[model samples]
Target: MEIDIKKHLTFPVFLICFLLIISLIFIFPALKMIVLGAILAYLIKPIAFKIQSKLKYSSVSIIIAMITVIIPLIVLVGYISYELYSVVSTIITSGSILDINQFISQCINYLHINVNPNELSQSVTSSFETIISYVMNYSVSIVSKFANLSLDLFILVCSVFYFVRDGDKCLKFIKSFIPDDSINFFDKTIEDIKNVLRSIFYGHFLTAIIIGIFGCIGYSILGYPFGAFLGVLTGILQLIPIFGPWPIYWTLFFIDVISGNYPRAVVVLLFGFFLSGVDMYIRPALSSHYADIHPLILLVGFLAGPLVYGIVGFIAGPLILGITYTVLDSYRKEYLMGDE
Candidate 1:
């Protein structure tokens, strides 16, 4: 007897079952790492493409791109991590924020300001002390868990290499699923995604570099010993929402003051002021704020992402929000705007 399998297994049924299986098998455990890999892949693929044209081997091209892109970043991150840990450890061991407190006292005393710099209640200091304890505890945990994190990072790197080399395959596979009527809509959505990624990777990162460059030049001119690393640290910290370059420079300013380097302290304060203004102008020029996703949205994402998703959340949270906002916005304009 001949069987008509098409009647028993429709396209939608097959698609649903296939997608469910795919999601169940891999999506849950590795989804976070994959997302990070996708971001790196998006940024590095163009360079890989350029190399691929000349090298005639995807593998060789991918290695060139990976080394070019990932190594320098690793170096920079390692420097920042080392410096921050060193500084924080020094402060905790020798343990005096008094230079800063003294400077603040002088400012309030001379400027006749209402700001009470010395008003940090014993209670407040103890609260901060408690927070520092938690951080120390977490650092120990981070050391213990390094193996797991390394494995995840390795998986992420492998994902990035394949993505840079064969990311087009993923795009093609996705495109295959789009219905004919939805082609135009799908293309527009893809453009929206491109725009959002541009804002995050190019706009945000370039702005950070600009701030970093300024820090480097300013600190070098003022004769700080670790100026380049300080600037880099400033730039990396710029990635966070509320924390800016002020904390680094201001601390340095206080250190200079305590060391009786009045000239350099003044210079540090000046650079701090100048770079603050530079950020206002330069960031807007670098990246487009897609769909005007509110700063509040970003602030929430920056704060909450880490709480929920560990370190990766800090980058992912704001980006995912922007993309989601654009998608919903487009749908509203197309389907809901007119109806209401």
Candidate 2:
């Protein structure tokens, strides 16, 4: 009477998997954008729902929410890009670099180092020129591929809209595939994944924002040029596992030291130390309520993600890894430990 259930299901499951593989192959090029959109949608869903409570129209709420959130992000990115270009171009063209070179020479002499200052200056100039040139070329390539970029952006927007609106439906549909026995595991895994996301967002990203703000205020008070930009860079560097605001403040400190500004140097160094030290408290305080993710997971994700998924991979990599970890842990708890 059982009628060989496993035998009958095998062909159907195979057929479904085959179709999925084919579909994935076709959408491989736009996969990153699609993933990015889904991630954004997940983050934006609450905002959209808040708006929907007022508007009573899901689509309109989502649109307005997207605009409000996405516009500021776009503007911030554009401003950073423009400022970076301006700084690089100015450095490449201006005589200010010579002053920096002179500073380097003075530092070397003060240290009683026998290295050739002219050779070192030439090397620094050459390295900067090469890096700037490469970045400029890369920027040009991105502009040249406007059509492709537009297509990706279009796909991203569409994906976010649909995912935000239908995400619950999608989750239900997925749940339908889970066996009754494993449903608890699936639910637990999803909860863990959500916790992971919250942990990363609050622990890492929020900390970065706070540190960046402090950097901006401190550097400006110290009379540094491009203080805001340095702060932004500090924030970004804070996202990486091993690196923090030390690089920015240390460099500034050394620059001040070479320029004979000891007071500013000491102040900036102390400020930088504060920025670094505060992260220890802030990250744990924010994330401890959620999942505890290992630093290695994030480090690998951040480092290797861009290679596979481009810039969007930065977000996707850690997320995917964190989710994977949660799923594995859930499986162990539900199956392995349960059996034990």
Candidate 3:
């Protein structure tokens, strides 16, 4: 007896399948991390391949490349942490609070305004003390989280190794699963992803390094306190769109203002402004040239990524959008428009 397929499959079966997929997603979140690592490995494959060709050992080359990349990052973090601690210590010991209060009072007096400076000073000091206490308490939890993150880092490193070793075979296997008609489309999409990664690595990451180096050198030359910390802050902020460097620059400016070091502050501000403007030109030009994508698309992606996925969203957002556009264009040209 012949049976109808639709009669046997019902709404409940669909619901069960949906729930099962969702559960699997939660259980296998590591898949996302692996995918991220694979993308990173692909971007750095050229360097790994070169090293392997010279050394004749893929595993050793991969490990050496990973260490070469990771060591600088570790050193940067350690330096920044130490510099920030030094700044905090200096702020606690120096009479910065009193100087700031006096400067505020002088400004108010010059404006012909009458106010109780002593009361204002006391209130500000109390608030600052409370904030310091809260931050001290919070540091404990932050340290605990850092310790746990070590495990995640280990997983990420392992994933990077496997991705580098098997990346070519993996891509080939995945391509085999795609339909013959859509192979070209898939190839174009992969190329788009590579372009995006290249843009990110060259444009964003390299620009950040340049800015950080400039900041550190400039601040140190000008005898700015916590120069290293400010530089690192500036670099990290560069990762954020638009307002990233403003906070660090402004904080240093205000500190100078309160300390009666207006000349130094003005110089720092001018230097920062120049460096930041240069970054604007460098990032867009590099991104456009490498990715062959519109700068406007990148600008929009930078803004939209954080709104959609928080910090990591910036990278993910641009990548996903770029791939989508490439795939859709390929589909239109091949099947619908029949041009390519």
In model 1, the runs with Cα more than 4 Å from the true position are 1-22, 84-136, 253-263, 289-292, 337-340
TM-score of each: 0.79, 0.94, 0.79
Instruction: Name the TM-score of candidate 1.
Output: 0.79
Report clashes for each candidate as comma-separated counts: 0, 0, 0
Candidate 1 local lDDT, 121-211, one digit each (tens): 3445678789989989998998999998898888898999988877888888998989987777777788787787787766667888888
> Residue 49 CA error for candidate 1 (Å)?
0.9
**Which candidate do you rate higher for lDDT, 1 or 2?**
2
Better model by lDDT: candidate 1 vs candidate 3 = 1
Candidate number that wins on TM-score, 1 or 2:
2
Candidate 2: what lDDT?
Answer: 0.88
Q: Sort the candidates on TM-score, descending order.
A: 2, 3, 1
Tens digit of per-residue lDDT, candidate 2, span 92-144? 68878888788879989888999999999999889988997998899899999
Badly placed stretches (over 4 Å) of model 3 are 1-27, 106-139, 142-148, 254-262, 292-311, 332-340
Q: Cα RMSD (Å) per model?
A: 5.2, 2.1, 4.7
Q: Output the number of the lDDT-best candidate.
A: 2
